[model samples]
Target chain A: MARRKGVESSIALADAVAMCKVDAISAYPITPQTHIVEHLSEWVNDGELDAEFIPVESEHSAMSAALGTSAVGARTFTATSSQGLALMHEILFIAPAMRLPVVMAVANRSLSGPISIWNDHSDIMAERDIGWIQIFAENGQECFDLTPACFKIAEDKRVILPTILNFDGFIVSHMIEPIEYWEQETFDKFLPEFEPQIRLDVKNPSTMGAVGVPEIYYEARMAQHMALVNSKPVIKEVFAEVSQITGREYKVVESYNMEKAEVALVMMGSLTETAMTAVNNLKAKGIEVGIVRPRLWRPFPTEEFLEVLGDISVIGCVDRAYTFGAASHPVASEVKSVLYTSDKRPQVREYVMGIGGRDVRIEEIEDMFMQLIEVKNTGKDFPIQYIGVRE
Target chain B: MEHLNVFASKLVPGRELFSPGHKACQGCAPALALRYLLKAAGPNTVVANATGCMEIISSAYPDIAWGVPWIHVAFENAAAVASGVESGIKVLQRKGKLAPGKVNVVAIGGDGGTFDIGLQALSGMLERGHDVLYLCYDNEAYMNTGIQRSSGTPMFASTTTSPAGEKVPGQSTGKKDLAAIAAAHNVSYVATANTSYPFDFMAKVDKAFSTSGSKLIHIFAPCPTGWRCQPSDIIKLGRLASQTGLFPLYEYQDGKYTMSEDLPFLKPIEKYLKLQGRYRHLSKEQIEIIQENINQRYEWLQKLSRVSQED
Candidate 1:
């Protein structure tokens, strides 16, 4: 049982992992993500948590160790940031393909090139298609709440896939907030004990992660894709169940002040809260603007996203990462693809705002809304643009 | 005693862990070596294999050849995975959830997966003192990927990536000494064996399973296709290579070095080199250079063995 109180979001995240009773944790130190693992190690050493803390050499080994631990039917957890997450790239694909159901937290940071250790979405964005259930947290409370939910959803029999939670590096990961912690009874009822479908048991032996030749490779990949896509409902149900236990509600796509609003902003991560504040400021000035943020990124809430943008005339997407030389950015590109074939498509404008930890304040978000309103009124959708750039 | 003999005749355990009718080439040395290894390890064992010829040939989707519970994650992670498995089992057993037994956790990899890309993970696994045995099946090159050269490739050996020509000879560098590297970790046991002698290889494997902490076995398994030798010469080549002072069979245990079989008189290196077509392009001068290198390495090993024995 956890005492409900104020704590650092990283500590809260580790506490939630402890409450859920993870059997193994493999980790290597990297910024912003180090606190979570450090707390886990302290818990293990202090005898607060009964788990194996595998202090590995690199993030690649971290993920690989998680794979092995999970393969043996043990509930496993790991955390990384920036290049650490990037280093675990190849092993990331194996966890889901083998149906290990390992839970990971990625403190979203920018990839290296003049190297900054601050917050951005570039690290997780580069791994968008690695086939894990990716979810974003907008604040410290969400970080605490979603850590357990990820384990529940991933370990569910119908959706035995790996899960990754992305919280902005140094923004929410380093922030302290009052969190509604869960007791053992609350967690146990909401998320039951994990029962692996297959394990390395001598009594009932089987082969896993075997060679998929050209004859069966396509079918194997198709099965994995279908499994990930089918996990959306499980994720929603787990979130609802967890929310019922602790009165903090969650949705796949959350909208703020969208009632009778004409223009809306679409974004993800901690910046969504800033955009919501911008919406509130605009609302006080009688400018009807709203914000929509998708908490679930991977099994991308296509239906819920389209339903949220139903009658809005102008929709502006604020992306924190760029896809160099691509026609569009990350979240905006997915948003465009979702609305491309729909009849209710709105005038979409994408603004690449926070690359390598560049600040995106309320004023910048308000300017983005102004640009979206102009694009809606004039019917001239501009090319993908950057905000706060020194021209 | 008669019933026991009948039971042993019918149910020879661990030999069936690696079944027949797989995709390995005819007279594959690694295959024979793995069979002997599993036979020594017994039935209560779990294995993790890196992506290579062994994984690819043994497990082709619905038609797997492994009888024991096994997994193959990716290349360059077998040691790390084995570490996790060993630690996980220990924790589970400590918590009284897992049934206690003599279950050995083993990681198997090819030369490329072991000596090159997988070295860091192996080093980490050893330094952490995980109770796992790592087996590196040294086939000299990346035979699964069509004879490409890896860090384990011998000097002056022709490979697809290191072809011999007028300007350049085959491989420019010598094989990385992985046994010494494993020894540097101060592990419990480290040994080098060849597939030709099943008794020697199995003896080392038995010792590894009995010892507690990290143990590694570097096996010299020749590739008939990659070496451009007759399939019948696989075992003969293994023996000849050992006899010619190229790949000595020895073990380092508890800071003590012991040779499985000491050489009374070292054979000429030409007897080993002339058996393979990959070394066919070597001139007289190159052969003499390789022979000199082998002699120096052999001398170093002998000195280390004497020093450790005296200590």
Candidate 2:
């Protein structure tokens, strides 16, 4: 039996992780990501979780220690945000290249310069091509459910790659939400005991993370790339299994009322929930506006996205992070590239909004849909717009 | 010391954990030190190696020289990685996933990694009191990257980065006292060994592995290529370093200090310095300064040992 309880989203995520029976956890404290590790440490101290919680010195050590635990065939986890993620940039690539299935959660916050600690996608956008299975959560429930699912997907022998679960900082991490916590028996059956394919063992001594000479470096990287590309089906299969156990379905690309609509709004993370409400308001005004959210950001869900696009003529791609001097923002550029060879390509307009904790109200989301409708009706080209920017 | 009755080969284990056929430079003292280290640790061990000459030579993808479990994560995190390996094994053993027994977790790094870049992680692991043995092969500089000057490079020793030029004689700063730093952490064991003294080095390795808590052994490995010395003089230089009181052999255990071997009279520093091309440019005044520094350091060690004896 699963019991519904009102708790902070970070607590819910920590509780969910405890249910997975992780062997080791290494984390450093960063704002918006602290509560998750704090709760885990409490659980470990209380003897409720049978694991080692290493309070590492820095985010760099946090990830490096995770590599040690995971390489030794232990289920390892860590969490961070913003500057912490940037500090861990070096080990992030090595985790995937070594095929160590470590799970991490990122409370997506803006990077420093102005040094703001708030909800945004700037942190994760910088790590777009690090070769991890990146997933986005729309709300607290999704964050809780994805915890075990990520562990399961990562530990699967077919897909021996680390996974990153991203949710908006402060906005989703700090919110109190009603989450259905799992019972011990149900949780145990969902995620099986981790049995690693390669591990550090005395009886079967082996070498790992060897120096890749030029003769083998290319093939080694190619094998890692192909493994990630081949993990899509495994991800989908695990999601289906999770849906069966939790009775809540999950999709790589989720659409809301996109059928027979002329225009759509595209995005990710918690903003999708706000976009759903905005879509309902547009429906009341006799405007057919739909929303398309890609839950799986990596291995980019091209087929599912194209299937949902159908005959829609225009889409407003709302990105929370800027790509600086590039043609468009990160999410919008990805959308455009995915639609390049499609038979019925939609007019994708780039919109950068809610940067560095700037508020994006319901009216702002409604306005984005309205802009897309105008783009459809007038057939006019417009430059990338930065919403909520003052002149 | 009395002469041993038996040959050295008949005393230790016959099996070699660190096999031969690696791409190390001829007479590489670090490689020899590692061979002796693995022999002391036996087979039930896991090594977390930092990126350096040893990792590159031993593990080149298709070939590996280690007969024991080894991992190389990156530079500057060997101690942190070893911490993870130790903790992982502990938790798993408690959970009945692994057999209950002694499994040595060792981290190996070079002078550049230990005395400089990897110092913070080493300090963290020691302060946290992890059950690990951190072995530092002090070749004195970043020999893997063509002899750049590191903090472990002795004063007035010339490296590529600290070249002896018209204005600068050699390395300007004194060598960082890594053993003292490790002792400052209040770890259970801290020792310094030389490759030429294999029995002393292996004895320290055995003590470090047998005892609990964080332990560190700083091995003085002579780098012929980096130090611009004859490869054949590797062992002779190591011996001279100790005889000259430049690199003393000592251990700090359980709040007490003990010298491995006490010399009645110190050899002149010139005997050690004159053999190396890097020190050939040193003036008589520079040699005096270096000798004075070494004498002061050796006296400090003797004072600490005398205090322990008095107590």
The candidate scoring highest on TM-score is 2
Question: Which stretches of candidate 2 lie above 4 Å from their native place?
Answer: B1-6
Q: TM-score for all predictions?
A: 0.97, 0.98
Question: What local distance difference test score does each model get?
Answer: 0.90, 0.91
Q: Could you give the DockQ of candidate 2?
A: 0.81
lDDT of 2 by residue, A292-322 (tens): 9999998788898899888888998999997
| TM-score of candidate 1 on Cα atoms, chains taken together | 0.97
Candidate 2 retains true contacts at a fraction of 0.71
Worst 10 residues of 1 chain B by lDDT: B7-16
- Tens-place lDDT per residue, model 2, B84-109, is 98999998999998888999999999
Q: How close is chain B to the truth by TM-score, in each candidate?
A: 0.95, 0.97
* Residue-level lDDT for B112 in candidate 2: 94
What would the per-residue lDDT of candidate 1 be over residues B1-311, giving only the tens digit for each residue?
Answer: 68966775554453567889989998789988778788888778899999899998999988888878898999999999998888788877777768888788999999999999999999999999999999999999999999999999999999999999788899999999998899999999999999998778888898998999999999999999899999999989999989998999999998988887888878889978899999999999999999999899988888889898995
For A129-201, candidate 1 gives per-residue lDDT tens digits of 9999999998888988898899999999999999999999988989888887877777777778778989998
